[model samples]
Target: MKEKAEKNKLLIGIILVLCIVILGGVIYFMKQKDQNPDSAFKPDLDSNAAAMEQGDGEDEPDGIRIPGYPSITIDADTTDVKMNLMNPEGNPCYFTFEIILSDTNETIYTSKMVEPGKAITNVTLKHGLEAGEYPAVIRITTASLEDGSAMNGANVETTLVVQQQ
Candidate 1:
């Protein structure tokens, strides 16, 4: 009887030790996870914005006159869309308008480079998109210098929700 009791006590001790080990491991892992909450997910707001603004500027035959990003939106039917061109630079500039689809980064429409100070009317979209919400980013770039380098460039981003008709 004494030997049997001793054996039972030893088994219980081993089991307790194992339970403590498992519990400590669990606690340590939980603390580590708490320390790194972003391990599972991360977001790149800047890149996403850039992608949405596919047509940043229009490259003119003479030079590139990119317009600064402004408040732009697309209608649900994927038909009507408008963007206000804002020129932050004190000097007047021109813009080549282009429409890029958010989903596939596709260039749907483009316009001839329009000089600054002259406002452009509604620019139609070329490729019709399916019903879904999307981001419509407008890119503005200036003409490259004689060195064949792009000059002033800026990105203006906005969200567009396209619904079915």
Candidate 2:
């Protein structure tokens, strides 16, 4: 009887240690996944801007099809939009930027021929738009590339809401 009790105590101790090890491994894996950009994790503005240049070629357009750009979200009171434009396709192309709100079309900004590869541009609006949901459209024209360049233009419409602070 004494020998059986001692063996039982030893088994319980080993089990507890195993559980602790498993728990630690799980926590470490969760942290690592959060740091991965490809995951559903959205980093701060600086990291997010860097990821804009990367994409999944599986969804990329073929033969001049415009790839959809990510949507933008901004606070209504934000007067200036800090943004970076990326040329994923390794070829030079032309692009036009516009905004449409409530059926009214207006040219908020434009980019003259973005050079091949990544071309980061900062566009400042002349006037701050009213706080509301608007359709952000980017029309890309590739007059040079033979395969039309795998250009995924802006597909995201920004929802600008002004919050009273």
Candidate 3:
């Protein structure tokens, strides 16, 4: 009877240790995830007033409206790209645009958080590319308007055309 009691206590001790280790691991991972910068989109609370003034003329849609960009043009000598990156007034969330080079999987440009009814007309690339056409992706990361939390997003494939200045 004494031996059985000792064995039961030992089993309980092992179970408690396992539970503690599992709980600690879960907590460690949760903290790591929260600390990761790319884990979620952090939104800019202030809306772009200038962009709001330059509205995209269209009736409000039923759902989130993701503007399409089939191509973008830029001057080879300069980093300024002529494109309208907008989040229509109809949308209920914020938008962050990332222009990534397809060939090298490099992000050339990342826009600030854009609110609904606003647009980003002028954008400067990270670096100037040579005069040529390059395949790229416009990765749109959306965030919740109410809480500024990460939300659904979209990727629009486009051709980045660099013209000789």
lDDT of 3 by residue, 84-149 (tens): 888878688888989999999999888878888778777888888999999999999988886687
After superposition, the stretches of candidate 3 with alpha carbons farther than 4 Å from their true spots are: 1-42, 45-49, 52-59
Pairs with steric clashes in candidate 3: 89-117
- Cα RMSD (Å) per model? 16.0, 16.2, 7.5
Among all candidates shown, the one with the greatest TM-score = 3
Give per-residue CA lDDT, model 1, range 102-136, as digits (tens). Answer: 66777666555443434444556775556665677
Root mean square deviation (Cα) for candidate 1: 16.0
Candidate 2, number of clashes: 3
Best by lDDT: 3
What's the TM for model 3?
A: 0.67
Provide the lowest-lDDT 10-residue window in model 1.
43-52
In candidate 3, clashing pairs total 1
Q: Residue 85, candidate 1: how far off, in angstroms?
A: 3.6
Residue 3 in model 3: lDDT: 100
- The 10 consecutive residues of candidate 3 with the worst lDDT sum are 45-54
Tell how far residue 77 is off in model 2, in angstroms.
4.0
